[model samples]
Target: MRPLLLLPLLITTASAADAVITYDEHIKPIFREHCLKCHGEDEQKADLNLANFTAVLKGGSGDKAVVAGRASTSLLFKAITAEDDAERMPPKKAAIPAPQIELIRQWIQGGLRESSASKSLVAARDTSFKAATALNFDGPPPMPESLPAFTPPQLKRPLPVIAMAASPRAPLIAVAGHEHVRLLDATTQQEIGALPFPEGQPNVIRFSRDGRVLMVAGGKPVQSGSVVLFEVKSGKRLTSVGDETDAVISADLSPDQKLIALGGSGKIVKVYGTDDGKLRHKLTKHTDWITALAFSPDGKSLASADRAGGIHLWDGTSGGILLTLAEHKAAVRALAWRSDSHMLASGGEDGLLIWWDTTDGWPAITNTNAHPPVRPAGYYGKLPNGVLALAFGPQGELLSAGRDKQVRLWAADGRALKSFASETALPLQTSITFDGKGLFAGDAAGAVRFWTTAN
Candidate 1:
């Protein structure tokens, strides 16, 4: 009887055992049960995919999850083996049992073989990859490739506008003002809607990634802080979150519309879950008030700027501080993350725009004084008079607006592209928004304007 029991146990551990643990049969189940619900099929957490062998190798968020025969060095294994409870994988739950853990180790050691169950997941991942790869634009034929003289547009309004954002799927644009928020048609320069707020002036207005929600932040005069969300088409109020007494200086949404990051109140960067308006994480690391927050395109990390001239990188899920950058000389006000690269673009009050390569953990790209440097008669100086807002166009162009009353476009590499100036004399403080087809500008007198390339 003892010999028969030994034979069965030996057969179970043998390489020819019927229950072969391949990437499809054993490893995928491990991920589904212990990993994927957060970082797998439903969502790509940490920019990683465990749904298939290919996606596991392609990696996500920051680094590769698997390294072929090196499970001990793989980020996925490292996360799962984290000694610190907060750093452990499937975070917020107990560690996986040892037998299940050994299966992952054996799978990694066996070259991570894939089975039929992984085919569907691999096909889905490949489709997404191909779609992203096939996107190519000629960029308006390079505008004849010459040093065209800068010509500022003539302004029709007299007051200043602060910030703006355009809807991705429509001609609608939202503009921020002293005491009102206005929506406009990007093609006709027509005011579509004007909503007034008596509680406080708005500091910024941005459209959600899906274009279904618009978020407005500002406090009324004598009242300091608040943030509001409204339906884009009907102008109906959706919900308001945070203290009305704490001024929300800047805000942005995650790429998937699952989170909102609010910059306000004593260096706090509050991240809220969009589904229930619940506080997900409150990042407290900046020494001064936060001025800007931008999530990376993959949605695993967040970049934040502050009045203390600091920029920070945070892990989106755990809210852990990953990096702190201090290259700006003054308050950092504007920040934009490139959609396909590990680079961050920032503008500061010191009249400079710099791009940092997050991969190298240093300032790898720089564009000093991004605004037009010369001031002609009735022309604001080159740099946005004050870098009040920054955004990325559909084709990845950088657009920025300044207190000096101008909006300038820049190539992804930080080269100057174009500049638009209103012909008016009111010291513009303009807000600019863009759709793939055109650019929209809003000014202080509650006027919105549009510009586009002639077809």
Candidate 2:
């Protein structure tokens, strides 16, 4: 008799416990932290992609990630459920919990509905500024064409920033976030000026050595990519570089202002003439996405680093590969050359600070972990994490920021001088820039933070 009265209550509780696991609410976050990096952006390994709804439906190499309503037979499910460590879904991870696996099982056995996250993914994929084009050596593409006619509100939503730079000569710091660039006063962090980059989110922003012209590189994914030169003081568009089909991930303005070099998804670094925007060198050697590029302080040498930890030095005037420097174990995200251009400082996925003797056949001068390898996410302290930004202080000290959300300074010889954590950031301060007096970092909260020497 008592059970009769409580039966309906128990039934309601059980139904509530089986709440739906929609892509946005339950699944995306799990995939976001664990799977997307390799199968999503930057590169699609094994041709498999979990970045979007369509990609999941159009599975890679092994084919059919999910056959709707058949989770047990799906390759995606099998990979996750495989008992053999080598066959596991993450391939390398300790194994996903049974609860998450069961949740995913329910999702597939149910139907892969176009949830809110799926719709958003589809929208982002379709919002390419320009349809992707093949790599062409013809003079860079033109702006406006390189940019979409209408900016997508989603891309303009101030995604986590990837680039921040301080003018070595001016009291200005340039922060590239979402679809615009903000120039802030180095001392006060006040907005000095802003540039509307409807072309796409800027991937990198650099002020000319004198701090008068700001060189910006970025573009839509799988779409037109280009660089713009803006008169920092007047906020006028000065010059633009073209002929790219993807966002420009890295760029540098030569010290002498004679040449500018940049590289990104194309796997080729293109060096251009600053005066006429002419293609000067089509430096090709990188087999993966180019992640870092720089013209030496003297502007006599150009250094390019890629996701595979490859480093190449090229003749400044000729665009000829001079040497392939000692590389990293994983992607090298940050590169800083000594003021004299005698040494190069690099930090990457290994969480190590490496000094390269650029003049001595680019030999490794010092290799030490900038931060201890974080476990579970990082193996043996190995990547999927590392220093994402580096800058040389006015006194030649190296400044670096990384996934650990820490800022550390190192002596010219690679001695760890100081380290500290700011209370404001969520984590992963990805970009660091030095303005002679202060260190500026870009955080995941869509903020550019300035830390003084005293801090």
The lDDT of each candidate is 0.64, 0.68
lDDT of 1: 0.64
RMSD of each: 21.2, 20.4
- Clash pairs, candidate 2, are 140-242, 140-243, 141-242, 141-243, 373-381
RMSD of 1: 21.2
Q: Could you give candidate 2's per-residue lDDT for residues 296-350 as a string of tens digits? A: 8777788899999888889888888888875466798888877667777788886
Candidate 1: tens digits of C-alpha lDDT, residues 37-58: 8776778867787877778878
Give me the candidate number with maximum TM-score.
2
Estimated TM-score for each candidate: 0.59, 0.63
Model 1 TM-score is 0.59
- By summed lDDT, which 10 consecutive residues of candidate 1 come out lowest? 1-10
Q: How many backbone collisions does model 2 have?
A: 5
Best by lDDT: 2
